[model samples]
Target: MPATILIVDDNELNLRLATRVLEKDGYQTTTALNGFEALELCDQNPPDLAILDVMMPDMDGYELCRRMRENPKLKHTPIIILTALSSVDDRLQAFDVGADDFLSKPFVPAELLARVKVFLRHLEVRAVGNENQMARKIAVFSLRGGVGVSTLATNLAAGMSQLWGDETALVDMAFFNGQSALMFDLPMRNTWGDLAQIPEEEIDAEVLNQVMLRHSSGTRVLAAPRSAVNADQISEEKVSHVFELLQEQYPYIIYDLPHDFSATTLVALDSADKILLLIAPELASVRAAGMALTVFEELGYPDEKVELVLNWNFQSQGLPRGEIEAALKRKLSIVIPYVADSIVTAITMGKPPILSMPETPLGALFEDLAFRWSAPEQKKKRPESPTDAWRRIAERMRKRAKAASS
Candidate 1:
């Protein structure tokens, strides 16, 4: 049976257009001229998803959405607000009313269908109740700057989103000067600055959603503030609360941490499930990693929880991997081969290799890293509705299992 959609709009022409387009695409669509009729229809038979227009005379979409959320029978159904009001305020209102998505009016059919597909697919998965995997929180760090910490963090977050088609968040904890948003080519519409002054008690899912910037690749970014002064306004407690909220909502959370071990940095590092402590193939980076390891030990963080990654940022001669491992007293868990030209181009183009070139060496490396460190439960069970990315994961798992047995 096809998924049913309820499209509520006051304009008959708009209703017919949406209904025809959706039905033509093999979805079962029902239409209503106002929110009252839509509510009556929902009571009779709730839709899998609701596409509501905002300007209904009987009751606006925002009110209808709030009422629908309060309805026990229709609470879990995803609601998407479609309106000509494309302003940020309108979108924020929709989110406040419990909308799962928002689309501006005069939307393309393909874009509408794509959003519907993702919404339905997520609904189907939730209906199965197979998602027991807890969110994995990862902190990508380096005591030394320019060791590709942010680069790796960005790719890992984006890669995980692409792989599972689930929500992933990249949190830029480098409050002073973070570039997670720039790497994704996202405008500084909303960032951590929004939450810096908000009372800690008021910081919840809704507030966090308002601050997070969504990327085109399905990843969300909690960006650093644009101004350096705003960084101080954000407290360590606020950082902790934000991470707590993110951990509950996102399936994967990657923190792009700053170089120093400040109070805020310590808070994030403490909450992390795994720490990717990156080091370059240079003496300075090696010494920094060693110091970081010593601090991790002092903080009682286990050796297994930290993965020391060797990033070859430059092709010039530097300390050997063996010597670095000996000095740190731990074997390197992963190595990122130098691809200076490609990496530079990726940065300049504002497309991470994971999104722009997943088949490339750097891209595959990040994908493999994401797979290796994901929650163990996710690795054990296959999702009910598998995407192309999921299929690739399954194939990779099979190969790894076979190799291990052999």
Candidate 2:
């Protein structure tokens, strides 16, 4: 399909000339004699890019650009000021009103065509970079090593994507020896290692996208560097910037954080909407969870934002749940029973059980957890076009509720 370009000019001759030039270059043109007509047309069908004449009756291009930027539906559409005023001050003012580019009125036909193609290309790129606005950020952290942190994080991120059919970003905040990418069997084609050398200021949504490794399960993994030396090159500022960027595009951003309270880990914890603190059924793990809870209190994070999950990392007997809860002074929210062989096989194959075995008991548990931790919009009444995954989850939930009532 040809790119749609909205041309707004009060002068009929200029409108016809601009429209003809763009249409000749295989662009679909919509001509508007005034700003009001342009806005009305935009409301009806927003264009891919807009070309506006600065000099207009009642509303100038600057004002019209501002209005368009304020409209959520058309806010991201590229705006170019096509005007006779070629002064620096006029160009700056046009940009101040959110105009992407300012072209002089007496533009060379080739130059005009070139600018249109460039802006339309930019519009398409922006559309690709701007994904779903995921409002929640969940971080899975453990104060002790080998506590199933990565396993939980990977499954939660993948399961949320499966349950809600929304974008989920899994970040390896471990920086060193992170297995987030390996858990999904994704090759490290792009990882945080690539962004380590880039300036923090240069990183944004597009830059992040360049380094993310997409999985078949609709989860995007920002893996840590395979080498510790490369991992050390990544700055805390860069990790912070990546988190800010991910929050805008993914509904659920899950962090497989390192065990220590390093600068990078602290940034993820601070920005997390919910922290799933994982602890195993062991003395050392219980003690670590207690210490973590103390730190959370010191950080002034609300109790509700933190959930304790007990995973039976070992098959043998260990600390009981009651004693662990008493030690931490917080109730355990969820517990994962020992499924050692299955978990090991899944991890070795780089397929989380949530995606590989959705019909199994372990798979159902993770799906339920994903649904419970999802954003409010996902939990709202069934959408018009529901997926099989959503239907199965809804039916299972209804059955569970009925069982409880009985």
- Give the root-mean-square deviation of each candidate in angstroms: 7.0, 15.3
Q: Which pairs of residues have clashing backbones in candidate 1?
A: none
Which consecutive 10 residues in model 1 have the weakest lDDT in total? 122-131
Which segments of candidate 2 are over 4 A away from where they belong?
A: 1-134
Q: Report the poorest 10 consecutive residues by lDDT, candidate 2.
A: 118-127
Q: What lDDT tens digits, residue by residue, belong to model 2 across residues 1-406?
A: 7789999999999888888888888899998998999999999999988999999989999999999988988765767888888887997788678776678978787888766664454345455765546558898998999999999999999988777765578999898789898898765756888889788888887677657766656687899987888898887788877887777777678889999999889999999889999999988899898889999999999999999999998998888989988888899999999998889999998899998888888988888888888877768888678756677789899999999999
Residue 114 lDDT (model 1): 77
Name the runs in model 1 displaced over 4 angstroms.
1-112, 115-133, 396-406
lDDT of 1 by residue, 10-30 (tens): 999999999988999899999
**Whole-structure CA lDDT of model 2:** 0.84
